[model samples]
Target: MPELPEVETTRVGISPHIQGQTLHQVVVRDARLRWPVPTDLAANVEGKPLRRVVRRGKYLLFEFDHGAIIGHLGMTGSMRIVNHEEPPAYHDHVDLVFSGVTLRYRDPRRFGCILWQENPVMAHVLLASLGPEPLSDEFDVAHLLRACKGKKQAIKSLIMDGKQVVGVGNIYANEALFMAGIHPHRQAGRISAERLDRLVVCCKQVLSAAIKQGGTTLRDFVDSEGKPGYFKQQLQVYGRAGQACVTCDQHLTESRLGQRSTVYCKRCQR
Candidate 1:
């Protein structure tokens, strides 16, 4: 699935081409996505100019005059900019046609969504309860400590919870925890305030780095320009379970937490 970095990457990549451009048309090759593409999508957006593309967590908001189009790049979904005359291929499900180019959406698994919402797009149920963005000032040490209060969930799981802090997906969580020297299975409430503070800084650092590198392309992730991310090559503990730790010489360990694969260096992370 495309996480925060991936989603942000797509937003930035496509914004240059579509921002301030008039929407020429809305073409829906398949309306059967995670949810049905809004039946009146064209009526709402076809003639309006796209004001901007903003990202909240993993969802992208295509802002216009009266409303916004909410899009999610689910497990196998991606958006790319193609010439207006380019032919649609298999899995290419939707297109927001513009004067010069088309923003095409493709989803092999159809788990993504394209929906229309009126003003105050954030109030939609899908986004109403989401936590702060990991890179924002709202997701600081103090905020995390409060969420951790009296919680017995594993620190990794707590951080991964959308209601606690959005966009700390499994991969970034592992990397951030390793950077902070916190074990993935540690109790959230049992962690020291100082350590949690460091964890907050590390999470921001890791996420910023991933976004700078165009996100980690474990699989099925590409920028709006169709280029794969290069961050995976720099991973320390997320996928190198049996490999040597980058910090300590000890071998990294792998386990399943919340049913997601977790890799850590036991010697480096307490």
Candidate 2:
């Protein structure tokens, strides 16, 4: 699935192209996705002029005069800018045609989403309960410490929790934990506030840098320009199990935490 960085990259890549364009129409080649693409999506958005584009959590919000459109690029989903009349590819499930350009949404795995909202988007149920954006003021070390209090969950899983902090997915989680020198399996509540502070900083830095680099492409994901993210080349431990640690020269170990593969240097992390 596309994480926050990938989604943010897409938002940045496609925004300038689609921002001021009016929604001429919606073309739904397939409404069956992770959730149904609303049959009335076109009718709801046809004449709405796009006011702005923004991102929250992993979703993109295309602000319109009266409402907004929210989109998610799931495991194999992406959006591209093209001529409004471009023929739909096999997986091009939807399009928002503008005067001269169209934004095409494609999802080979059919797990993405295209939804409509006629009210404040953040209040929508899907986004209402989400935690603070990791890069926002509300997500500092103090906030993270509060969220981790008394939790027995693995620190990895705790940070991955959307209600605790949005967008710390598996890959970035591994990188952040490795940078913070914390074992992914460490009990969330037992971590020192000082160490947790390091984690908070690493999470923000890793995520911000990944977004700037267009996200670490782990197969399926690409920028709106169809370019793969370059951050994967800089990975320290996510997929380097059984390899030598970059920091300590110790052998990196692989284990499972919260049912996801985890890689860390036991000598470097506690």
Candidate 3:
């Protein structure tokens, strides 16, 4: 699935092309998605200028005059800007046509969504209970320490929880924890405040770095420009299990945490 940095990268790539441009048409080749595409989508959005574009968590918000359109790039879902005359390829499910270009949404698994929300888009059910954006000032050491209070959950899983901090997905979580030298299996409540503070900083740094590199593209993820991210080249732990640890020259270890792949260096992280 596209994580926060991936989504943010998409938002940045496509914003300049679509923001403030008048929507000339709406073409839904397939309404079957994670949720049914609203039948009245075109009526509500066609012919209006996209006022702004932004991201919250992993969702993209295309703001308009009266309401907004919310988009989710599920596992294998991607959006790209294509020429208006370009033919839709396989799995290209939806398109929002602007003056001379089309914003295309493709999802092979159909787990992504393009839905409508009223004026206060944040209040939408899909977004209402999400935690603070990982890159936002609202997400800080104090907040993470509070969430970690008295929780026996593995620190990795705790940070991955959407209600605790949005967008710290498996890849970034592993990288962040490795950067902070915190073992993934450590109990959240047992971690000292100082280490949690280090984790908070590392999370932000990892995410910011990923976004700068256009997100990590292990597979099926690309920026709106259809470009693969380069951050994977900088990853220290996530997919390098069984390989030498970048920091300590020790062998990295791989295991399962909450059924997701967890990789760490026993010598480097505790």
Q: Write the per-residue lDDT of candidate 2 for residues 1-270, one digit (tens) a residue.
A: 789999999999999988887888898989999999988788888977888889988899988877788899989999989875568889999988888888999999998889988777788888999999999988988998998899898999999999999988999999999999999999999999999999999999999889888898788898998899999988999889998999888989999887888999999999
Candidate 3 on 106-214: residue-level lDDT in tens?
A: 9999999999997888889989999998888999999999999999999999999999999899999999999999999999999999999999999999999999999
Candidate 3 wrong stretches, greater than 4 Å: none
Give me the displacement of residue 104 in model 2, in angstroms. 0.4
Q: Pairing residues by index, what is the TM-score of model 3?
A: 0.98
Model 2, position 41: C-alpha lDDT score: 84
Model 1 whole-model lDDT (C-alpha atoms): 0.94
**What's the CA error at residue 174 for candidate 2, in Å?**
0.4
TM-score of each: 0.98, 0.97, 0.98
Tens-place lDDT digits, model 1, residues 112-221: 99999998888899999999989989998899999999989999999999998998999999999999999999999999999999999999999999999999898899
Model 2: number of backbone collisions: 0
Supply candidate 3's per-residue lDDT for 258. 95
- Write out the backbone clash pairs for model 1: none
